[model samples]
Target chain A: MDCTIVKIGGSIIDSPEQLQRFLQDFASISGAKILVHGGGVMASRLQKALGQQPVMVDGRRVTDEQALKAVVMVYAGWCGKNIVAGLQSLGCSAIGVSGADADLIRAVRRAPVPVDYGYVGDITPESINTDFLTLLLRAGITPVFCAVTHDGCGQLLNTNADTVASCLAAALAQTGHISLTYCFEKDGVLYDKDDDSSVIPEISSGMYRSLRSEGRIAAGMIPKLDNAFAALRNGVSEITVTHARSLLSGKGTKIIL
Target chain B: MDCTIVKIGGSIIDSPEQLQRFLQDFASISGAKILVHGGGVMASRLQKALGQQPVMVDGRRVTDEQALKAVVMVYAGWCGKNIVAGLQSLGCSAIGVSGADADLIRAVRRAPVPVDYGYVGDITPESINTDFLTLLLRAGITPVFCAVTHDGCGQLLNTNADTVASCLAAALAQTGHISLTYCFEKDGVLYDKDDDSSVIPEISSGMYRSLRSEGRIAAGMIPKLDNAFAALRNGVSEITVTHARSLLSGKGTKIIL
Candidate 1:
């Protein structure tokens, strides 16, 4: 069976109205589907509320012990459960989970050599438990995942949501065709940063190299595109970057090999 | 198959060492089993950190909007995921969940006619989705549940963990024999509030009534025992109140019909 994996960014999740609309579209997706989400904005806000200053390096959170607790609370607890509840209200049977739940994803703590990203975990397709995921998909249940994974030795680790989605897509692709979508605030990869309508319809690896050389692609989007290309190189059938509202509209930039 | 349902109170959850020990014992329980947990102490601490004053009426949290969010973060997020991770480390396949997940347990919002408990939910045996739970149990996955439930209309509500355990036992009893256990700091229902070793081996309905009439039962134990009796009336096979350490020792107060 074909599977669809949709990952929503923190911008969409931070807004209740936007999240509801996105979930409505997500619930309408037919076939086996999964939702992976990031709650960085909320997690940062919670950290501030608790008097901990959030540190970010190169657009990635520098998770300390305190920050890890905040993310676990926000991502797995607040955002994940609320999203599941919203989907359930729309008549979609959704199960909210962290990677630790059923050992769905086991991550190794990142080696703190170059830069110590405390409690951050790095994962690949090998880390996913595809058998259990297949079981859930076969049962007609949509899994809603938060970017909280666990090391097999009983430690919860914070992971990048984009990495989780891409790896999950790659893992699921082993059994069947899988499509991965990255949904955020933008329409797609834009030709002009200031223009909303300047979405580039498609991008090839050659074009991506030139775009990077010309500094046309935003620095922030580099990691996402890298993840996209990696998923493509693995076994993912297709990958797209699009606005959250245009999930089923086929109005996103599709990545090409 | 026989199933065991155990509910741990907030006191045990607030201490890391205590919780780990409890999970180790909980993991060794054979057969299909479930864990229900309460994180009230942690929730209250988070609530205070978030600048919300937790109000309790009759020992039940009067969950306002802020308190609701705090509990959701603490119970379902931090505590639930951590417990699942701990159990997984102990070689137990555990899945952490809130009531909203897969709509495992749907609750009705409490009516305001009785002093308004802002966002509280009440559940019964009929509220449980036994089919899905059975599927998980048969698949050898032990579910770790927190005290957060949701109304079918997409609202998460605070629920008493003891009620969740008893109700789940009653619901699962429809298909098979179920034993419910409530574990806390105390060895069992005590004969005297001041005496730690004065554990009551057993209590019948007659003794319970007389104890309550004589004011011998602790005020807090009343609701838990009430839930136990209700579960017995509703078809649960057996119920026990025991200390967290004596889960498998067969030493505790047994409730008899």
Candidate 2:
């Protein structure tokens, strides 16, 4: 069996119209699929509204106890459920979940010796419950995941959505062909951060190093590309970075090993 | 096969220690089971924090757009996932969900003819997707549901948790024996408002009618008992109102026809 795992970033999720449009395109895709989403923008807004300061270090959120609650409320509750409802309206059977649900993705809390990202977790391919995921996929249920995980011991942890998608793809790649797609506000990984038309058609490992050395890749895209290459190495068949609306058209950057 | 459906009210959910104790007892239940939860207290606090006023009419929430968002975040996002994680820590495979997830429960938005409850939905036994639920139960996955439903058209609505439990019990009763239990702060239906030890052991329909007629029933307990009777009439094998701590003790008010 073949599976498609799409990761939508917070920018797309922040806009209702854009999200609905993306979901419409997503619903049109056939076969086993999963949607992993980021809700950082919403979470930040919620934190601000609730009198908590949103803090970030090296583009990763510093998820303190309050931030964890905000992310869980925004990501799993508001954003994830809305996406599931939207997909359902488009005739797709979508189930929204966090990694804690059914122990789908158990993560270990990151060590505090390095930057002290409170309540943040790191996951791997082995952390994913592929058997359970396979059952749902085979049963025609599309899982919509929010970027929230657990430590297997009752503690919820905030995770990066891109990492979640990559790990899920890598884990599921053991049984079937898996296609990993990163959809965000931009058309693709841009050579120039200011220019939308500067999307690199494709990038190999060597080219990625050269681009990084030349400072052509945006700061925000380095981690995403790293996750992409990791998935490729872990048996994922294909990886693409594209705009949310360009899902069906395949107009984006493809990552190759 | 027999199944237990437990509905935990907001009062119990508002206390961490009480909820943890209840989850421990719930994990000890040796059978297929489902947990439905209400987070009205949390939702109300969240609404106030977000500068939104929560209004209730006839004990039903007036779920305007903002209120709906607050409730969805608190119930489905915060409360539901935490419970799932707690149960998972206790070795119960729990999956948390809203009604929109997998289209598990589709509800109809209430009409404004009688009273306009904005974004409020009404559901029945036919609204539940029992096949998907049964599949999860057979797979040893305990579903933890939040009292949020969808209109099957990208609209999330606020629903009473008690009603959700009764409907689920009635719907699942078509295939197997179902027991519906309502867990709250008090021990059971009380003979007097101020007496915690004055639990009415059993109540028949005649006694219920007399209690209601004599103004002996509390305003809050009426709807819960009404939902219990509805479930009993709809083929549920048993119904009980018990304290959260008394889950395994069987020391509660049993409703009989």
Candidate 3:
């Protein structure tokens, strides 16, 4: 993959020292790149501080207007800006962007179904403005994206980070060969759920299904893995699941079809 | 100015109805444009909401670590993102940015003299990335900037809105015929301080000095005009001081050499 789109999970963002170390490694990767990041843990904490208990329905946190604002503040404001600044300090030029920026990504508000997700956005790869993003990338600016999108009619919508990464890798595949990575606290897709060092070196889609049948993979990992596989199908060259610290060395699980 | 750089002061931002009107008019103006905005009032209020009383000395707010975070959250997160979204609603494509984004503007932290204004940044026209800005503008993306800058070494600093506007207008003058506008609650620099309709239609630099000597201008207007005059002298073709409602019709005080 000539250009990498890395999705750094919320766990990496919880510790400042760890986050700085991760950025130091992320900046060392050579090529035009993009960063899409998660905000759940931080957003939840900030929401509590602002006197609102986060509302969770069916194991998913519902995004109300207040919650949306809180998350936008944390992801786009704290994480996105500081990550770009950290990259700058490391001699890698980066720019922070929300989906509303330059109309880079336009999403449709999710329709209320079995439950109302409330201000959640759903995006397709076709909705992304690859032409404008290519201009930014060719100019040598690494676009650091937050988990916020716009409805084109001017409303901010909360989006899942993994989905953002998947859509971007698919949309921007033509810019260069695309490598999509999901970095979190774990080493990779683990062979033993309880052991941090039990990294499974490789997992094909059929293997992923068998592991799911055996109930080995965590429930939360399913959607993320689904996103990774979708990205691969849509033309991302490869998918890597690793802890942020090991990104530069390429030590992690590689997903295959 | 072929490209207009407009600074919306905190006074105008204080009122939601007024801000919306201003943005509508700002979006209606034809040609490339950039928006610089002030945030001390909103940031202070948010800081107070978060249980931190703002520290103020001699008309200036001290930007301690907490205050800096407060301002960044308010300006870059809430204000900047929403402004771009608001402009999008008006059919203008705008992207929000901090100085750290794309290395658009670099600044140096202010040194302690009589008072340590901790975390405040001072910038010059030379520090702005005119080339990058021109690219964004040429691509028809309006840049909405917050009062946040970076020290290039990973520190984000709080810069004055007027300074951000002045520097941008001066630096971007080469892009086209430049007209810089400062929009606030008041109509313009008023001849009679109590009367909003008593705006001084035109104030030459010599006239500004004479008005200063005569003690007719308000103290706050002095610095804003100083910035306006500086932009005019730095190759910006014109400077307008007006209320947001008068933005397109060009009804306001015009500063001259």
Candidate 4:
């Protein structure tokens, strides 16, 4: 059976209705699938409530010791468990996990050079344990992962959610057909920034280059699209950028090679 | 293979050096073992930090919605992950889990009768999923559990840690010889509350009744011992109450029929 790697951003996660709808769609998938989610919006909000200032370089939060702890509590503790429980309620057997749980993903603490991204971990394709993941998938258990990873040396590192999804898709691709879906607030890669309905139906590699040159793509969408392309290059069969509530449909932008 | 169910209370968990030493000793156990931990101390501390009051009725904390969220974050998020990471550092493949993770333990929400225990969950021996747990253990993965369970219908409920351990021990007893161990602050059941060396090395059910009747046992130790005896009655072969740092030895109190 084909495996679908679906990633939901903070927008869908922050809304109960959107999350419930998304999970229902996710649970209805015919075969093996994985759901990777982002809870950064909630994490940042929580950080503020704890009187800690959130440091963001570009769109990525700088994960200091305090931020890491707070985010782990928000993401893994609240967000991940709620999702897993919701899936369980929907007759879907999903196991919530962090990288630290089973050493499922052995990541490296990102080197401090251009940015001192404290307690941030980055994983290569080598870091993914397909054998371990395959075991769970084969047992008909859906693996719902939070955006936290570990260095295999007693550190729980906060990694980017989109990156986590992309890396997982690339690594799991070694075994079978993998479709990477990026579910976000917008329906797709919008052609006009102000127009919600002006989603680009599809974007080919050549067209992506032209759009970038013309500055048509939103700045925030670049990193995610870049991740999608990276996954495609590595072996993921398809890439869809869509609204989470509208998942299980080709209602958004499809990235083509 | 004999399975050992080891439960560590809040005392050991509050100290890092002690916890590390305990985990190291726990990692060295001869056969399949499960680690169940308590985080009530930390939960209380966190509850206060969040400006919430801890309400205890008849020695059990009344789990309000706010307190339940705090404790879940403290137990399942901060406390559980650190223990799992520590075990991983010690070369043991430990997976941190909450009941919500795999539905490993399904519990009934404590009903509002004598006291309104807002979000507490209680599990019987039948509530534990042996087949699923057996799969993890057979794969050479140690299951580390936090003091959180679910209603199997989506509600994540706060559970008593000591009760969780006892119930797990008795439940797992059907498949193999199961030993239940409670590692706490004192070396064992103490003869004198203030004396470190006053460890009661052994206690029979008759002796426990006499000790309780004479007021020799501390008030806090009663419920724990009660749980231990209940596990014993339910088919658990051996129950040891010991110092977490001095585990792997008969250094604590042994409960005998």
Highest DockQ: which candidate? Answer: 2
User: Could you give the interface RMSD of candidate 2 in angstroms?
Assistant: 0.5
For A137-173, candidate 4 gives per-residue lDDT tens digits of 9888899988888888888898888888999999988
Interface RMSD of each: 0.5, 0.5, 0.9, 1.1
lDDT of 4 by residue, B24-69 (tens): 8999997799999998898898788777899988778899888887
Chain B global fold similarity (TM-score) for predicted model 2 against the true chain B: 0.98
- Model 4, C-alpha of A15: deviation from truth (Å): 1.5
Best-to-worst ranking by lDDT: 2, 1, 3, 4
Q: Which digits, one per residue and each the tens of the lDDT, describe model 3 over residues A163-239?
A: 99999998977656899999998889987788888899998899999999998887778888888888888888989
Error of 4 at B145 (Å): 0.2
Ranking by DockQ: 2, 1, 3, 4
Quality class of the docking in candidate 3, CAPRI style? medium
Q: For residues B24-110, could you state the per-residue lDDT of candidate 3 as single tens digits?
A: 989988889999998778888878878899998755679999888888888898788888888988899999999999898899999
For model 3 chain B, where is the 10-residue window of minimal lDDT? B55-64
Candidate 2 pairs with clashing backbones: none
Q: What range of 10 consecutive residues in model 3 chain A has the weakest lDDT sum? A: A56-65
Give each model's whole-structure lDDT.
Answer: 0.93, 0.94, 0.87, 0.87
lDDT of 2 by residue, A81-187 (tens): 99999999999999998999999999999999769999999999999998899999999999999999999899999999999999999999999899999999999
CAPRI verdict (incorrect, acceptable, medium, high) for model 1: high
Task: List each candidate's DockQ score.
Answer: 0.90, 0.92, 0.77, 0.72
